[model samples]
Target: MDIDVFAATHAQEWKRLDELVRRRRSLAGEEVDELVDLYQRVSTHLSVVRSAGQDPNLVARLSALVARARSAVTGAHSSSWSEVSGFFTRTFPGTLYRLRWWWIGASAGTLLVAFLAGAWVVLDPEVLNAMQTPEAMRQYVEHDFANYYAENPGTSFSAQVWTNNAWVAAQAIVFGVFLALPTIAVLAMNGAGIGSSAGMMIVHGRGEEFFSLILPHGFLELTAVFVAGGVGLKLGWTIIEPGDRPRLRALGEEARAAMAVALGLVVVLFVSGLVEGLVTGNMVRGRIATPVGLGIGFFVEVLFLAYVYTVGKRAYRKGETGDIRNTPEAVPVAG
Candidate 1:
């Protein structure tokens, strides 16, 4: 093959491809077809130039031109529903499993703080006095606590709880971007609320009432919050200590994981909210319904943990990071 002759022959086609690609607007149907055709020809021309020992610079230029033209012809690819399906089935759970340790630690810390706070309030009269006046505390324990469940219709109450809990989870996930202090604060605040409420109920001799009202939904609701806090704390830790990866890269990777956990928790919180409203609100047979709802929540949490350990671990081992199908694009994995 005569290199110079071949170059001269294809130079006009190459120039035409450059012009078509540089055009910034939509191409006509004919032009689009031309783009694909020219792309194919240019690809072949580059191959020939490389094989025939053409000028290195010219071959390189043609190679770059072909790549651009091919991309132009193909346009950007869109994600399919199958990718979304794969996300929930593989990536989401897998990511959860990988970061399970981070969240477990978060949960342990928060629970410890909560239990201590509750015990302090219950044992020391001064601690309860610091929180509220005796009259106010008595009012809350005797009436406000129980009335809270029945003040609104069950459906509306469920929606209210769901949205509020979702907002808290969202805050935890987003605030984690700032070195995790906000997330820790939110967890401590939530834990304190639960502890104080339970301690107050027990002190007022309404322990059974509190158990029936809280146990039905508290387990799942609190578990979801714990998971959110755990993921958020992990995000913050990633930023502070990205290990071998660049700090920004690690933060970005963990940020995506945090966001996924935030979104997944919305559904979990909603289910818990429904249990709270329906079981706790139903004065009729609520005692029977409460334990049943508690069992349901516990079952769900166990299933989720089991899934993460089994399915999620397998997926993580296979290199799924729960970052969606951003493959063929260099994704920065933190660890």
Candidate 2:
């Protein structure tokens, strides 16, 4: 096909399509129909021009014209406050509810590991000694551990904690592609760290103090971590078992859902960070009573659980999969 001849033949339609798109907002009913018709014809012209491998300039012009015309025909999407509200009320909770089993198991398994690790440390003097010198252990149990929360200013500390925890959560979700080994490692390391700390405190008779400080934030913070780990494992498992969908397609779907969890966790971790830096820190500093702090943290944790079960369950029931709404179906590929 002669590029010049093709351009001359379709030049009029392209010009008309451009005009229609520019005046799309004020188009009359007949003009709208005409715009749609020209949009299709120009799209075909673009395909033909590209396939012919002639006149790159002409191809570029047609591509841009087609894009504008298509947008005019289909309309454009814009973000709104409703989208933000829907994310929290429906998407986040629904995702949490849908993946409830995965995260719950993660929580149970992590807690068990923590328990076993603490028990081991308490039961074995040699193991405990190997972990730290007796003096250092005493220092940590008596002062260092408690001082951690109050050492930094509350606002900065909260920001620091939020960033650190968010990074951990992101790692768990992103690294899940490696068969979840990294996610498991992350969870195990977290559990062992908590358990060892608890063991050290319990051995020194500060177990009550430990719980008072840790539980005030650990309840929610740890849950967020568990959610990330569970979602990561689910992602890894998707690679192993994609169900009825093609492996790549299934992975794509789950990966998108994992991203939603990742984003939701940022907010979750932020709240936990505030509790840790403000409530727990104040309790350590004697500004707030230990019992009140504990109650506040517990309440927050309970609130999150309630949100998941209520909003999340409702959204899931309504067919919310936590994935982006209206995701285009994957095109079939030949093997």
lDDT of 1 at 104: 85
Candidate 2 structure lDDT:
0.86
How high is the CA lDDT of each candidate model?
Answer: 0.77, 0.86
Residue 96, model 1: Cα distance from true site in angstroms: 1.2
Instruction: List the RMSD of every prediction in angstroms.
Output: 10.2, 7.6
User: All candidates' TM-scores?
Assistant: 0.74, 0.80
Off by over 4 Å in 1: 1-81, 283-288, 329-335
- Residues 143-232, model 1: lDDT tens digits: 788889888988999999999999988887788888999999999998888888778787778878887677767777877888888888
lDDT of 2 by residue, 1-335 (tens): 67788788878888888888999999999999999999877777776765554454565566668767767888974468877899999888998999999999889988998999999989999989999888888888778999999999999999999999999999988888998999999999999989988898898898999999999999999999999999999999988997876566567668878999899999999999999999999998899998899999999999999999999999999998876564223333222
